[model samples]
Target chain A: MIRAVLALARSDLFRWHRSPALVAATLIPALSMGVMVVALTYAVGRQPVALVIEDHGPVADHIIQIIRESDGFFLVERTREEALADMKAQRVAAVITIPAGFEDRVGSHDAKLDVFINNVDLDFSDDVRRSINEAVVEVDAPSLATLGENDLPPGTVSGIPNPYRIDVAERDLRTPDVSFLAYQMVPVLALLSLTAGALVTALAIAGEREVGALRLVRLSPVPRTAVVAGRLLGGTVASGALLSAVVLAATLTDVLSPPAGRWPLLMLLLLVTAVGSVGLGVLVGLLTRRVTTTAMLGVNVATASFLLGGGFTTIAFLPDFVQGVARAFPTYYAVEGVREVLFYDSMPTLGRNLAALTATAVVSLVVGSVALARVSARPH
Target chain B: MSSWWRAFDGGLRTQLRSFLRTPMTAFLVLILPINLLLLLSLFALTGYNAPTALVMGEDTAAARSYVEALEDTHNSFELRPMDLATAQDQLKRARLVAILEIPPGFEAGVQAGHTVPVNLTLDNVNLDMAEDVRRAVPAAAVIFAARNAFPEVRIEADLRNLLPRDTGYVQYLGVSAVALAACIAGAVLGGTVTAREWELGTARLSQLAPGGAAAVLAGRLAAAAVAGVVASSVTALIVWFGYSVHPVHPLEVGLTLVATVFACTMLGGLVGAGLRRVMPVAPLLIGTLLPFYLDSGALEPQRFDGEWLFALAHLSPTYYSVGVMEHAYHGLVVTPEPRWLLLLALVAIGLASLAALPRVARR
Candidate 1:
């Protein structure tokens, strides 16, 4: 049985090596998401705005500095006419102007900073709205805090009153901020494992059925268990190889700096995930024998797995029902497991993830082999 | 000309009938993108409200009022009332994005006519969510000041919006998803039929027919675009009725989709001709859709995404597709380029891809 399984696995790997198109089909989705992280990195937290300084006074300069310091807005130096042109052309998200006589209005307490925003959609406008609200109030924030904090001092310093005075004093709980792109890349990598494992196995099995090779295997002395075991072996190895390459690339480029000594754990978790997914793939292959159907459904199944497995966010944080659904899928454990290995050395759920994935693999292999035997026993 | 028409008619009729019978094709063209739309819309339904914890150390009127102001913030934070210890613990564990601590001021400072500071402890795990918290706090503070009706010097924003009203996030993404539907339909509908022809040796059959392979390819390409239109219409209706995003210029919206679908199907057909296999073509196009969606500014205009990313946006046809689609659906000109020019670019993409594929199959 061992010899038969090894031979079958070797043959499948050889065929996959020869069929570049089949392999390409499997890797595409995860690769595309890898490309997507770069774009997503830029899409969030940096919106370009044209800051037109109509007043070159010190106060106006102060406002400019505030806008410049804002994390959300990317300010470019442009003249008023230039800014207007950019705004009219939709070249910038918004045009914030420190209008002429702005300091005079501030002195008289009748100032309203002008903001002409291209509030195209709530997603874009909300960022600008919140930032602008913060920027405008920031001018009075320091004075208010200083005057209010002084005990029995003069009524005002730099002449800002303390009536109804309230300000925000921020205390960050974490030292270094994680880039959204890097955090999201973790999910993307798990998705790659899920896609490659299921897709590659499904296509290989589909190919075998399409060309009548499965009938030959059934006629031979090889046990059904050997054949299914072979399929899982080939699929897990392929997926593991892809996962290794991606992790290597990411680490080499300094994109992913997982803590030292975590690579082996990461490798183990992802490979086990691939094993479980490939078992499902074997069943998928048996169900859809045609290459066309198998290819389409393989992508679909993997996608469904990725989505149900806590896509782009934490499963524990999701609504209870959604989390319940996520727990039913193995990829969920894989995603959570990978995050643990990468971010924290001591993962509380590491044992649970390993147990769940191992059980899934065992169940899938048994079911897949039984299904294969049933199908082979049927009339041609 | 009559033979050409006959061949074209045959190819069109064949694909349409074939597509209706093919459940797999239907699943890819219509069901997949629709499922994505539904799943994604569910996420957006949270209205981008990030979860944060509020720890009220003081039970005074000032603290309560400040909490009220935080609630009034523009869908920025979903405030969860928690004790300071619990909030700090969640923040450390990365479960909560931030914790707003209303320290034990007791409103005494407010009664003394002094400014009191509310501390905000942020996890800052991901700067994207953290910054939203960072900005929302001060914005909330400003509101806190305004509600007090303070007689002190206060500056407000005199805002001028380009649009008459703010377009909702779902409304925008749902509309752009129609263009996405077009892409899926084009690749699956058009690409598959073309690849299936070669996979089943129908390429030779077309080669032997009247007007040669080119006429059949053209017919199939046209039929694919037409199929894409029908498939995407279902998506559009769902976006309209399901998501309630009625088009501002209904006729123009239809035309924009037609143009986008037409272009996409042709490109898909081009890829099909080159790859010549149904297995690789569908997954390839579907797989790449994510990057294409992001690059094309499906969620927001690319200019705001930064210079390098914006420059890369020009490489995707989706950039042009969403540009015209947004204008047609919401009357919002999202692109700096002329709308007509953008539409023209989509058409050119279709024509150019069609031109590149071997229409005649000379070999």
Candidate 2:
């Protein structure tokens, strides 16, 4: 049985290799996903702002120094006009204007400040607002400390305490090196499963029809179940090898640094996902008798699934309703399952996803088998 | 009087009928952009508070009071109490786009007449959102602090707010639909109807007819352009009427249709003629072309930032088609308006035809 599956898998893999277009389909998505991850990471990290100081006073200077110390922002002193121009150009992400007399006014209890931002760039504007507000809160920190002893609330800190306690816990399971690789690699899992699921079933059945092979296979005494299983095995092997290569590349390159205990479980998850993908492909092929229609449907579903499943962006940031809408697609599960393996180092949730995927596979296999059986049983 | 005109008319009618038949083509043509416009308008329903963050100095009840105050104050924000790393991750995903970190010595700094260090982590991906969070958070924090500390020094923000009115994902989608129409037309007809003829070796027989190779190629291009224009125009009209999207100009809108058809024809015809087989290569063509469709600002364009992507967008005839459509929707004065956009479109269409001519002529 192992040898048969292996033989089927090897043939399917070779078919992919021989077909230049199929090879391009898989390779382009993998590369595209890698590029997208880098773009997102860089976009997230590079946050710079323009700082406008209306008061060039000693106290305002002290606040500017504190702003410089934060390391969260880059402060460039520019006029209001300069800042607005820069913000419009997207050269400066946001603008912070420290109002005139900002420092002395804080002691007088009438401190007022104004900040300007180009609302077109929503993310950076939000960040600048937060940073500048914190700076204001910090400026008022000194004056508020000097009031009467009773003026302070119980928990309000008037001064430093005894021993400062610091506890650090790393919630991200993947290491930085693997984190980057995991970032690049995770997108492929979705690309592979959807492509594999749709392709295997469609091509296997369609190619047989084209070559007059399905007609002959139906004439044989071998149960239609055997033929369907054989094709499923072939698809599983192809998808498995492709997925395993991605895992091996990520692992070797330090992109997938799974905890030692989780290795067995991760492998199981990969195998199950591949099986489910193949079942989906077979079902698509069986339903769409025409080769062209099957192939088109396969590409459409694969591409659309990747975009809508939150594989490219975080699900949380998307509108509240879109997230729920995203879950209805299987691509979401593939991504969520893989993300769990990489981020949490746990597999039971992945196991549940695998179970769900397996159920989907079983149903697809049964439906595909019935459909193919009927088509084969026909006179033509 | 001319055979070319007859071929063109024949090509247009056959193409239009075939286009109207497919549910996929018709749906994408008529519904996708309109649906997107409706989706974008949903953003006008404001008062949905983005989840916010507050870093606590003492990690005690007072900190809870501070966070609860923020929550109760506005319908626009929900405060999340978190540590530095969690806050950082939230900001990274634009989840908690703003984070208020109360330093270890925050309360102590307040008491000693020292600078109390409070850090606000801002997600700068959306610059506007970052700025709003920056201003609103500090103002809220200072107001609370004023009631506690120096009650005399009332801190108020005279905000110079110049925020862009919220535009919908649908507007963006409306921009993308123009590009999608070209791709769908290319996918449905390009190189296929004609390439299918060539694959079946009917090209030789057609070449032997009275008008010959030029006439056949003209007919094929006419068919493709008609399909491309109708699909794109239908989508555009739906966007205009259904969503009230205003184009940069009526001429630019017409130009968008022309440019997309030319692009679809050149790319699809070139691929169709170049590949020898009909069935296998068709899937390959669709797969390879599929990315260009999605990537070409059809769904979203600004997310990618390589020089290659920029250069590709500039070079794409579809990009100009989409750009013209965008200018129309946004009503941007394209310098001298229609003249410059038309000149560029003509030059692009001319170049596209020239590139394909050599390849088709050899066949």
Candidate 3:
């Protein structure tokens, strides 16, 4: 039985080595994930803005200076007409216009700043609006007072009094801050593992069936269980190796931390995820029995898992209904488990995650084993 | 000329029949676009809701007023009144996004015109959500201060939106989704169909035909372009009816999709002729689609991202398609010269088609 399993595993390995397209398909998602992480870092924060200062007064200059100092705005000075044109072309997110007014308006404390924003994306537009509000606060900071400074005369002090202060003392409960790229890369790594294991197994099985090789195996005296076990073992090893390489690269590149004492937990989670994906892939192959259909199914399943299982976006950000659906996918547990170990330095939900993954792996393997046995028992 | 026309018609019919026979082709060309639209729309509808806990240490009027102020603001946080211990527990469990605590003597300090600090504990596990909380807290404080200050001094900042209306993230993505549908149908489905002939050893049939390979290839290209248009149109209709994004100029939307389909179809034909295999076509097209989708002002204007990405956007058909679609849907002029861009895209399509015709005609 062991010899039969080893022979089957070696054949599958040789097949994988010959099929460059299949190998490339398995690795494409991981490559794309890397690019996504880099792109996302560049995409967030620090939007471009056009500054059209119609007023040459000190107050206008001060506001412009404040806008420049804020990290949120990357300012480009333009004339009013030019700013309008640039905004129409989407070269800038918004146009900050200082209306024609003398510095005398500041003495009256009724100075107003006009802002024209292209509110296409609420998130980025909100950032622009918030920055503008902060600038307003800074401009008006001189007239404000601290908690107990109201009794002092306003003009007696050289500086401004900040009367109402709302201090935000942030206490983050997690470990050191994870970069956006690192945070998003965690799920991408898991997604790569899932896709590679499932698709490779499914394609290998379906391709064998298509080429009449599985029928030849069935006619032989080898036990059907050995063949199935060998296939699963081969897939798990291949996918596990790929996933480990990805994790190693991420850690070496400083995209993720290799938490000491947690490598065992991480490896266990990865192994279970691979086994579960391979089992699921064998089931898909048994059902489809065609390479093209199985490949399409694999792609669709991988995409659904990636999108709905918190691969690109956080599960907490999803709606309640979607979150419920996400919980049903094994990728969700794997992602959450990996993130908890790598980022938070704690294994709070390891038991639950492990139980879910193990349940998935056992159920899929049982069903797949039975189905493959039945198919092998059929007359060719 | 008559014989060539007859051959083209025959080839078109044959291509359509073959496409209908293949279940995968039908699914990719027809069903995938609708599925993507619905999924992307669902993603758009799932707005960000921050889970927050309000820890009131002192039941003072100012503290009560502050809590009320937070509740009244048009914020994304789902604030609930909880004790400190419960808040801490929830935060540790990742159930809560942030906790806002009003300490004791908060009302006295504020009533005496003192800068009383509001303790805000944030789970910065997700920095995007944390940033939202940071921005919202200060805005809420300003609102509370404005309401309670003795001398009412308000800053009058006149804000004007340049766009006709606010476009939601989903709505923006929906427009891009239409373009994306066009690309997938034209490239993946069309490329697969065209390449399958070579893979299945049927290219000789076209090479031996009376009308030559150009006529047969034209028919296939036409069928693929039509399928691309139909798929993209269905996606547009879904976006219109389902997402409430009505295009101001429906004709422009149609024209943009048709042009995109033609351009992408030719590009796919080039790929099909070059690769001569169906298995690699899907992955290649889909893999390339993502970077194009991301860089082509799908999420936001490409130019605003940075100069490099903005320059890179010019190389993708999606960028021009998105430009025209944005103009049609939201009346936003995202590109400086959209017509020129479209013309350039058409020129590229013509060049690619010319380049691919010889390859498809080869024995």
Which candidate ranks first by lDDT, i.e. highest? 1
Give per-residue CA lDDT, model 3, range A188-273, as digits (tens). 87778787788888888887787777787767788889988888888888888898888888779898775688888888888899
Q: Which candidate ranks first by TM-score, i.e. highest? A: 1
Q: What does candidate 3's lDDT look like per residue over B1-363, in tens digits?
A: 686887778778887887677666466457666766655555455333467998888997788878776765434467878999999877776667788888888888777766665677777777666655655665566567666753423343556887666667778888888887787777765676677667777676776778876777778778777777887888889888878899998988888888888888887877777778666676667667766677888878788887888888777788888888888888766666666576567558746775755756473
Over B6-97, each residue of candidate 1 has an lDDT whose tens digit, in order, gives 78888888777876777664665666667666655644544456778888777888788888888877778888898988886666554677
What's model 2's lDDT at A267? 74
Docking quality level of the chain pair in candidate 3: acceptable
Tell me how far the alpha carbon of residue A112 in candidate 2 is from the true structure, in angstroms, after superposition: 7.9
The TM-score of the first chain in every model comes to 0.86, 0.73, 0.88
> What are the models' TM-scores?
0.91, 0.71, 0.89
True contacts kept of 3: 0.41
lDDT of each: 0.75, 0.55, 0.73
Could you tell me the lDDT of residue B309 within candidate 1? 70
Q: What is the DockQ of candidate 2?
A: 0.21
Q: What range of 10 consecutive residues in model 3 chain A has the weakest lDDT sum?
A: A145-154
List the DockQ of the predictions in order. Answer: 0.55, 0.21, 0.42
Give lDDT tens digits, candidate 1, residues A1-380.
99888887788788888887887897887777667667667677667899877776666677778788876788886888999898886679888888888877876677778888888888778888888887776676654322112232322233344434765555554345566776668768778887788888888878778877777766877777777677778888888888889889888877677778887888888788888878888888888888878877766666666666655555555567877877888888887777677665357788898899889988987898788777766556
Q: List, in the given order, the native-contact fraction of each candidate.
A: 0.69, 0.19, 0.41
